[model samples]
Target: MTRRPRVLPLEAPLHEAARIMRDEGIGDVLVTLGGRLCGLVTDRDIVIRGVAERRDAAHTTLGEVCSAALVTVGPDDDLGTAARLMRDQAVRRLPVVDAERRPVGIVSIGDLARVDGLGPGVLAGICQAPPNV
Candidate 1:
């Protein structure tokens, strides 16, 4: 797993985060503090909360819309488990954290796809064979 994902501080204005996301071609940012994972922000947050509320993105801090209920996984977690979490939660991104909840990296559907050689209807990695007795 790649370490130190591009992060945005919760104190940063929502607009700044949006700019970074667009510039980086990523849809989400890990909200971090002192190198620890705290929360997360996404483009959906920008549109659903910031624009819908008519809040000034330039002045609105990520703390306003960052989902503090962060669902995370460890770097050692298998990609399948992460996929299950995404499907169960209907979330597109997940913060890869250590046992102490410190941010190690970030994972997204894009990342997972990259892992499995995504192409022509490929889903994810086939890590194990079917059980046979």
Candidate 2:
């Protein structure tokens, strides 16, 4: 899990968020509203919802593209729980949150692939797939 998650306000520009993801070498970032975790946005979201839609990145807001129906896990939740949530939601990532629903960290399918004994073959398949844009 990445403890220091990249966070941005809901009104942040889509292009700026994409640049931050590229610079941080991360596929997703936490989106906040009034200093609370409100949602999350991924590279795939940017490509499909922003670029592919031809929405001006500089004008588009994270609130317009982020996954607002969040699938999150508490900080103390077990890895199995996290995996189950991911599978049930068909999402690749989950934001670890605190009691107040504040994002504490971020976890991805890749983070569990090896430790969960889902071999490299499976991991590679997931990582190598192109964005569904």
Candidate 3:
């Protein structure tokens, strides 16, 4: 899991979120509302929901573009469980949280492959996939 995952306030502009992703070399950012996890915004979300949809990104907030239905994993979760969750949810990344649901880190399929030896094909597919829809 990647500790200290990037987070953005719900009101943050899409342009700023995109900037963060570019600078951080990440595909997504966790969206927070009042210091609580609320949603996730990805590069694909920016394009499909922001640009292609013709929304003014400078004025649009992360909350408007982010996905609220989150599929997270606990820090103690086994790799198999985590993998299953990813497959079931069709998500490439999973936020690792504490009991309080505070995000402590993030795990991507690539990370799983590196650490747990998930299949290379799975890792490649996830790495090649467009950011979370």
Candidate 4:
């Protein structure tokens, strides 16, 4: 529920964005401008939109396929409320946003699974946190 998240700038190359995602071991990246959430890009977008479409990662910008239709929620919103919104909307990720539309941490189905009040092992496969914690 932090109010500041790691973000990729609009001009970053698609490949670089994907690299960062992989390096961070996260599935999505929040795009920002002037410190506010502007878009969201996921692994699926890269493979489907970028690769399937034959986009040149070297030349393609994150802004090209980044979904400006960011489904976001306030930090104060409960985990259950956030999970329901994601499920009902058929989205895998949500960008936590502030009143000014600034991105906070992201919550994916994985993160939600952790908060679903399930027992420990219930999330071992879902959240994909670093191993051997």
Cα-based lDDT for every prediction: 0.79, 0.88, 0.86, 0.80
Best by TM-score: 2
Q: lDDT tens digits, residues 1-133, model 4?
A: 4335568888889998888777866667888878788998888989988999999999998899889986789888988888788989998888998899878687777766665455656564646557332
Each model's TM-score, in the order given?
0.79, 0.86, 0.85, 0.85
Which number leads on lDDT? 2
Q: Candidate 4, residue 75: CA error in Å?
A: 1.2
Clashes of 1: 0
Task: State the lDDT of candidate 3 residue by residue for 8-122, as single tens digits.
Answer: 8999999999999988678889888777778889999999999999999899999899999999989899888888999999999898878877777888887777664455666
What candidate 4 gets wrong by more than 4 Å, as runs, is: 1-4, 121-124, 129-133
Using alpha carbons, what is the TM-score of model 1? Answer: 0.79
Q: For model 2, how does the per-residue alpha-carbon lDDT over 1-133 read when each residue is reduced to its tens digit?
A: 7697999999999998899888867789899987789999999999999989999999999999998999899989999999899999998899998988788998888777746564577775776566554
lDDT of 1 by residue, 26-122 (tens): 6678887776788888889889989999999888998898889877899899989998998899878888998877888877776676676445234
Count of clashing residue pairs in every prediction: 0, 0, 0, 0
